[model samples]
Target: MHGYAHDKDNYAKRLRRIEGQVRGLARMIEEDKYCIDVLTQVSATTKALQAVALGLLDEHLKHCVSEALAEGGEQAEDKIREASDAIARLVKS
Candidate 1:
């Protein structure tokens, strides 16, 4: 019943790719790669993670928050707050 259930496999694949990127980053460090190259890889990894986060946020809003709003009550308020908090965290990062 999870909001993201439909795209769970896609999410998993994206995460696995991110994991591989992280491993590559570690390997770069171990190999004493150029500082700028390492930094560029770090930026790419960060952007990939942000992309995933944004996708999840969009899904939550389109599905979970929309459903809660339709219900209209304490649950709706909670969902709004939860989504707001998530946005705040993303912004802070």
Candidate 2:
């Protein structure tokens, strides 16, 4: 029913990889890895997450928002507003 549903498996796989990256980050901290190395990995992990977010946003725009806009009414307006709020949150993050 959702925009990302079609590719849900891919999304889940990516999230699982990100989860492993996070666990690795914790391990690095426990091992007292070098600051710069840890920071680099952190940046990598952050970028991976951002990539997933952007992908989902793209799917939302192409599927959900487009469908609502095609219908052309209150639902369209609501979707546009909701998408805008989501974008704002992502930008702030």
Candidate 3:
């Protein structure tokens, strides 16, 4: 997917919501919420973080990788290798 730049405001808003979720999780822990409930929230937070990571990776591939490929040199190969390694780590998490 070729990514174009998105509005900074929207991205900030998304991050803010994720921050709120983290704070809520902390509060839940402090309040001694149910163990299962806490785990569920933790799962949701993990998913949210994964979503953000994937989005950034997609953007990098769409713009940076594409440009590197167009340049047609060792840089392009390096970027591909780096992106692959990052994706592997991401998936393992």
Candidate 4:
């Protein structure tokens, strides 16, 4: 398993909630709910996914990046670069 496997349960729970949120959005559309209400839920679900992603990124920095840095070599630089790129993509999204 990857490093984040330890967080599987929590991640799964969050994802399930997001899934439910999406289904709720679909239901709202089917029932002709207010556009604003549906958009509000969409925003909430986006933020929820962002929170989970940030948590995973934090753990990677704390554990994986820290370990790489402690080794004091090229790998450390590479890991830092990789993490930076990943964060940049997340931010852009």
Clash number for each model: 0, 0, 0, 0
Full candidate order by lDDT, most accurate first? 1, 2, 4, 3
lDDT string for model 4 (1-93, tens) is 355788889999999999999999999999999999989998998999999899889988988899899997999999999999999999998
lDDT for each residue of candidate 3 in 1-93, tens digit (9 for 90 to 100): 335356456556778888999999999999999999999999998998888788889888988888999998999999999899999999899
Q: Model 3, which residues run further than 4 Å from truth?
A: 1-7
RMSD of 3: 2.6
Q: Which has the higher lDDT value, candidate number 2 or candidate number 4?
A: 2
Better of 1 and 3 by TM-score: 1
Best by TM-score: 1
User: Candidate 2 residues 1-93, lDDT tens each?
Assistant: 999999999999999999999999999999999999999999999999999999999999999999999999999999999999999999999
lDDT of 4 at 91: 91
- Candidate 1 structure quality by residue, lDDT tens digits, 1-93: 878889999999999999999999999999999999999999999999999999999999999999999999999999999999999999999
Residue 3 of model 4: what lDDT?
55
Clashes of 4: 0
Q: Give the clash count for model 3.
A: 0
- Show where candidate 2 strays beyond 4 Å: none
Q: Which rank order by TM-score, best down to worst?
A: 1, 2, 3, 4
Give model 1 RMSD, 1 decimal.
0.5
Looking at candidate 4, the ten consecutive residues that score lowest on lDDT are 1-10
Q: Candidate 3, after superposition: displacement of residue 14 in Å?
A: 1.4
**TM-score for each candidate, following the candidate numbering:** 0.98, 0.97, 0.88, 0.87
CA error at residue 85 for candidate 3, angstroms: 1.4
lDDT of each: 0.97, 0.97, 0.87, 0.91
